[model samples]
Target: MDDDSATGVAMTRNGSTGERQLEGDYLTNAQGEDVVAGIRMTKDLSELKKEMPDLYAEFERIALLLEKHYREMQDMEFTIEKGKLWMLQTRDGKRTAQAAVRIAVEMADEGLIDRQTAVRRVKPEHVDFFLHPQFDPAALAGGKLLARGLNVSPGGAVGQVAFDANMAEAWAKNEGKAVIMVRPETKPDDVHGMLAAEGILTSRGGRTSHAALVARQFGKPAVVGASAITIDLTNREMTIGERTIHEGEWISIDGTAGVVYEGQLATMVPDIKDPWLIKLLDWADSFRTLGVWANADYPRDARRAVEYGAQGIGLCRSEHMFFETDRLPYFQKMIMADYPVERREALAALLPFQREDFAGLFRVMDGRPVIIRLIDPPLHEFLPDLVELVAELADLKIQLKHAPDMAAIDALLSDIRQKEQLRKRALSLREANPMLGLRGVRLGIYIPELTSMQVRAIFEAACMVVKEGIDVHPEVMIPLTSHVNELIRQRTVLEGEARTVMAEQGVTIGYKFGTMIELPRAALTADRIAEHAEFFSFGTNDLTQTTFGISRDDAEAGFLIEYMEGGILPANPFATLDRDGVGQLIDMAVRKGRASKPDLECGICGEHGGDPQSIALCHQLGLTYVSCSPFRVPIARLAAAHAALQETGRPHDE
Candidate 1:
């Protein structure tokens, strides 16, 4: 039989000379001794029962026997040669996430495996991938391949090309078009566009780049560092070899595969509420000892996390709350203000927005703890790029020389001068290393009103929610505390402002004050720092950066990949907890802090929290919870359960 031939049945009969021969006259001229007549072929396995009843019965019996012997599903291969069936091979088959879930559930139901074995078979990444949208296989097969890059985030997206952040935002919000934001790289300033676009594509940067980090946080599809593609921002186009794609042209990207396609492709969104997935997660919850929380900054995220069975909110970066179009201007004004009163006015303007946001989150996560981190990033992040401002100022000066009249000349000069002043101020604030400079607790301490304002908002929101008969557990976290005095100073401000808010609202609500142990100093001296802290939330993203003496944003796009490939590093420290270096700090901090304050609640709120290996490490360290993005809550829950099962060597009775 030909190896490529379809599965079929061939008929034969015994001849007078004791040889197998064709039973019909149609095979009279056939050369083979076992020439067959009325051969039937089928691509379906079920069709075999009708075409070859005996063979199908034998195949089913063999399959069942193999499965029983192996104690798992068996993928068998068989061949038919000269009308005789021959078994070829049998092994465990690889499966997609959907198949994995269904098989696990069905096998447990069939008594082939217990529920614990079923849960153990399904990996956490399988659950995460099963919940997202995927490209239709047929459509993707026909798509024209443009380039491939790092699969920084998972999902399928198809949209028109957008070159600039402003244009991407406008095309998405105003024209109501799905957009893929294509850039050489993204920065903190492009967050609005990243939010507005359907997906993100960058020609430069790796997994931990700004583009990748933000894309994962927002649960958007992203392909980064496609070096084969060249982005020409000046012409608003991108080129891959001979192919040039202009703005508004259709394109499709599979972030899971890191492939860029020339045109749109069909997509299928999986049902996250699939019955089997729900049952598995419920079993996971029963087994997990460590709590799984979400790092949700908005009410919508909090609601989604709750639906995914998150216990609480672990880290809410208050700085992210200021990135909205309506809020960014006020935040920028607060950053650029020259005097105390002006800054206070800007902060006051922002207070109502913060309060309303917190109130919404509190209402959604009514009985869950919400840890709101004070404004963490450096002030320079909120300001316009100094280089862009200087370039604009120079362009205005050139236009000034070609003015049509005195009125135009005066207007151009005034604009030029104002831009020049703004450029000077931006340049003045620039630091050689802004990440290590004025950020987190340093910023809060340098300008006491910043933390003071945020604490007031948190307390005010909690008080308002409490009066509405909602139980709220608000945690005020002071970010980047390297010394006991820093925590002490911030705690004093927090308590004072919290007290003021409760008195004003005429309501009392329970709350906790904590500090993020993100620096080596903080971890080493955690005993002293814990004196003022009721809890400790490890900011491993920064801790890894600080401990490694490398900037995560820069290293990931640069030597980090080389390090991992060369075996200099076991894994990306930013993605997985460095068990020897960074992990030691976390262990030390937890032990030291708990020693000082016996009830010190410790948890991790970092990118690693969503990672399976990192979640296991957090469990091993005896942390209270692991907090990750809202979309990753289910993955974290499952991983936490796996950790518990492995440690305890048994499953919880359902």
Candidate 2:
């Protein structure tokens, strides 16, 4: 054995997928980072046993001793000096969510730690990582790998390449194309493109780089510091391994493996429904007092959340139901209707859609409390893009001028008129800032009938489910409430409608009414709002926006990245809770709201709800539940458990 000797490390088992032995290549004359950096070619680690049998045996003995001493899995880095093995370092190993849970439980079974301690050992973020899809091993093996980099985030993505942020954004948004943004390194200016792109590739940056941190927060696949690839920003191209790919060229990136492929490779969705994971969550449940719900809008998502062990539905956004192609026309008609009768007609048509959507959600939830939020976004989202419509209208007018057939000209002229009218209406609907404009309760208050339709749909759906003898706990949640009267006005309409529906159906179904405490005003005045509201579900996405006066969509796309990377902002307030500003508001609201109504339920159903740090904060703030995306339920559950364990100090062994 020598100082420059090739070193090999093997995990006796696949720490990720529970496969057989997982071993890596042996790198000579290089440090550990060199091997992980994928900077040079290497040989198999198993070859070391044959090359140095006596040394390998001693190394094996030391590895076992270290693992036993640590009482946990160890990542051992060692060097051999002239036939003698010297253990350089040993620490708790980095394992995937599956591996972490499996190892922890097995260690507990072996009496190394208690089951509660086992639950505390695994991080919440790892659960989120486990839920992401992985590249198909067979497909990856067959594909031409262009380069390897630091896997900043974990997931797989395939898309046409874009050299810069603008190109990525334009390609994705304007052209309706998926893009993989490639850069020498990303800056705050590239945030917009980063958001639009399916994945990101950088020639330089480490795991904790701005690109990496942002990508992980957004759950986008990203590879950073692939120095093997040379990017030409001006040419909108990148060269890797003697091959050059231009803009729009197809490429696949596996952030988990840190490999970039020449073309789209197949992928397999990893099912986090492993029995070991379920057992891990069950153990988490025993330790945590906080509830874990999901922000599911569809029946499929609701079912998936239940499978993932969600306690209830926190924010079932009703606007998502309108985005379906079949339902968009009716919704657009409602948005563009000139008169109340016309609007009512459109709302009537949309009634069946809402009813069916809610019924399906309730049926899948099977009496799990479902918080149905009324439409929240501005109407323009439901309408055709005004700019695109205007462009189309211009093209049609030119076609009309050149038409040969009289009938064709008439039809073209009619289409032009229709599009022009819609475009005008859409333009009129546009606001300087839609996020602060006619949306949520403002929209509902302006058009009470619109809110009434959603309320009617909810109660009607609940009754339909009730007829099947299934208990239905439907909570009507009004979004974007800024004042107590706002909640009061909506509650009056909602309750009156609910009572009417119950009377009509000849069945009385109990339902609670609530408001989303999204604006700073709402939280500050929660005591007053709670008087009329049955519960408060904090919509932190909007709450963060309103509190900081930064739009969620714009903040990430603009200066927030710089603010974060430059250490100006401590963290992305959108991803992690702003404990000072937003947290204070939440604390005020929770304290006053609960005081106003003793049993007033409180929860958070925002992106931060799933975030491990945010979940811990929510638990500390006395939130009853934390809800996130369907895939994030396990993460939230684990985070809640971690928070509870920390408070109680019951599992301190880890």
lDDT, candidate 1, 78-163, per-residue tens? 65555456666776755667667776776677677878877888898679876788888788879999999999988899999999
Q: Residue 388 in candidate 1 has what lDDT?
A: 92
Give Cα-based local distance difference scores for all models: 0.83, 0.85
TM-score of each: 0.78, 0.85
Candidate 1 global CA lDDT score: 0.83
Q: Which stretches of candidate 2 lie over 4 Å from their true place?
A: 1-68, 75-96, 136-148, 158-162, 165-179, 188-196, 207-210, 233-252, 257-266, 392-417, 420-424, 652-654
The candidate 1 region of ten consecutive residues with least summed lDDT is: 13-22
Looking at model 2, residue 269 earns an lDDT score of 83
Top-scoring candidate (TM-score): 2
- Candidate 1: misplaced stretches above 4 Å? 1-42, 79-89, 137-264, 395-421, 651-653
RMSD of 1: 8.8
Among all windows of ten consecutive residues in candidate 2, which has the lowest summed lDDT?
15-24
